[model samples]
Target: PFRFSALTRSCVVIPCTFQYEEDIPLTRGIWSKKTGGIVFHNGQSNVIDHFKGRTKILGDLNEGNCSLEIDDIKPFDNGPFCFHAEKGHDKYRFNNSCVFIVMKSPEKPVMTPVPAEVDAGSTITVSCSVAHTCPSHPPVFSWSVPDLSSEISHTLTSPGIWETKSTITFMVAAGDGVRSLTCTAIFWRDKQQAGTVKLNVK
Candidate 1:
């Protein structure tokens, strides 16, 4: 059994399969979310309130398609989930997991002085970035500057799949006040939605 992580407001198709010495009297397949010390599962044709209407079993059970489909993902749902099957008086279990991280549209990007503290008129580079969601959808960067009026300046870059550093840079006055900065990332075949990181400069 295996699970995959999905970003907030995204979708993922988890692959599932099972193996055994002989065909047993398989009764039911259960998918549960591990939250705190509790387990949320679909049993007796009912789903736990927390996961109700959010979890769906995709594919055919008779065909052993225990895969699950979760949509409109949220950070809270990120976890190490357990998938189990029952056969007569015996049971088999597998741990399948994926972590979902939430990043919404940024209103402004954060600006930090290179040294964390600086004097007026000092040369400082303000940076911005977005969180990684999945392999298919990589993060991008953008910025909002006061001098541009209503226009936003964007510096887009390829996904750093192998590198840990992903950031955009800007040189600004140390005395600048109330500046808005933003980091944005877009994806999906439709290219409809994105995540943002916003900051307010003081």
Candidate 2:
């Protein structure tokens, strides 16, 4: 069983793989809900309307990859899903191989810089963090400063929740007084929120 978390109105990828006798040729792949509703199929005619243009197969069938991607995810999309495949003249369905999707709303990020003030020619570190409920789908952090060196880490804040932090270090110059550092957090479904901190360089 695979568990995944995503933000509503975002996208999610379900990882899948299959193996069979070397002589068997893989024909097609399918992704469906627990109720047997087709989310995606190699043939267009069989796919459900709600998932027609929103779903895609991310892997090559011939190589035994059956991964699926769901776009514009909705709250109702939360649930268990399964994969099916066709190999030569035989069809295979692994009921036990399933994924459970959990969706949540996104939150704004928090930014912190130690000392808040720094001396010219001094080095400083700024940290940006955010809390998210899905460790399986942790939020991604990025800095607005171009070519900036940054490090990222995550901690389990609680059951099923995680806190991710991104720290960036830079040297301050006398002329670079009153500068602002921006941090952007990207969550599932591509939803993004950002935070900024102002620095006073003496």
Candidate 3:
């Protein structure tokens, strides 16, 4: 059982893995909720209204990945959802494979390890990223560096994991020696978190 928490009005990706006894080709993927009620299938029909067009299998079915994505999270969308698959002539429903979705609160972003030494007059770029569910309102990154230029980007780094990163490249100065480099993640609804690391200029 796996779970993901998405922010309201955001999106959540629920990763799922499946197995079979035979080597037949996987032909279809299905998602059901609350006692076998199909919430998602190919096309629009047979899917519940609330989930129509908003839910789909993000993973490749042929690869035995039935991961699901639900966009624009609503309060009623909280679910302990399940996945099913059709492999050639054999069919199976993974009633035991359930993934839950929870609404999340903002958390601090983390930066990759930076080198301990930076040379004066040399340009360096530092990247910071955070996992978030909401792509529409991704967390924004801010730097404590004065008058520095930075680049911000978003990417789905893994199943159920979306990342927003901020990168800054700056010419190091002797005055920057032994200074703190801080990165902050500003999330939806005024939620914020930050992390800092020491930067040593040689």
**lDDT top scorer:** 3
Tell me how candidate 1 scores on lDDT. 0.45
Local distance difference test, per candidate?
Answer: 0.45, 0.76, 0.77
Quick one: ranking by TM-score, best first? 2, 3, 1
**lDDT tens digits by residue: candidate 3, 74-169:** 876777787878756666877457777878766678887778888777777888998887665688777887536788888998667788988888
Error of 3 at 167 (Å): 2.5
- Model 2 residue 50 CA deviation in Å: 0.2
For model 1, which pairs clash?
106-196, 108-181, 108-198, 108-199, 109-181, 109-182, 109-199
Q: What is candidate 1's CA lDDT for residue 106?
A: 23
Task: Please provide, for model 1 over 44-161, each residue's C-alpha lDDT reduced to its tens digit, 9 standing for 90 to 100.
Answer: 2456555666666665555666766555555666555566766766777654432233344322223333453344443444444333323333433334432222222333233211
The whole-model C-alpha lDDT of candidate 2 against the native structure comes to: 0.76
Going through the candidates in the order shown, the clash numbers are 7, 2, 0
Off by over 4 Å in 3: 21-24, 87-90, 111-127, 134-159, 171-202
Give lDDT tens digits, candidate 2, residues 1-202. Answer: 6787766776666667776556667777878888778888878889889888988887787777777778777888876888888766677886556888877667789987467677877777778899875444578887766434778898976533578888888776567478777789998657799988787778
**Ten residues in sequence with the least summed lDDT for candidate 3:** 17-26
The count of residue-pair clashes in candidate 2 stands at: 2
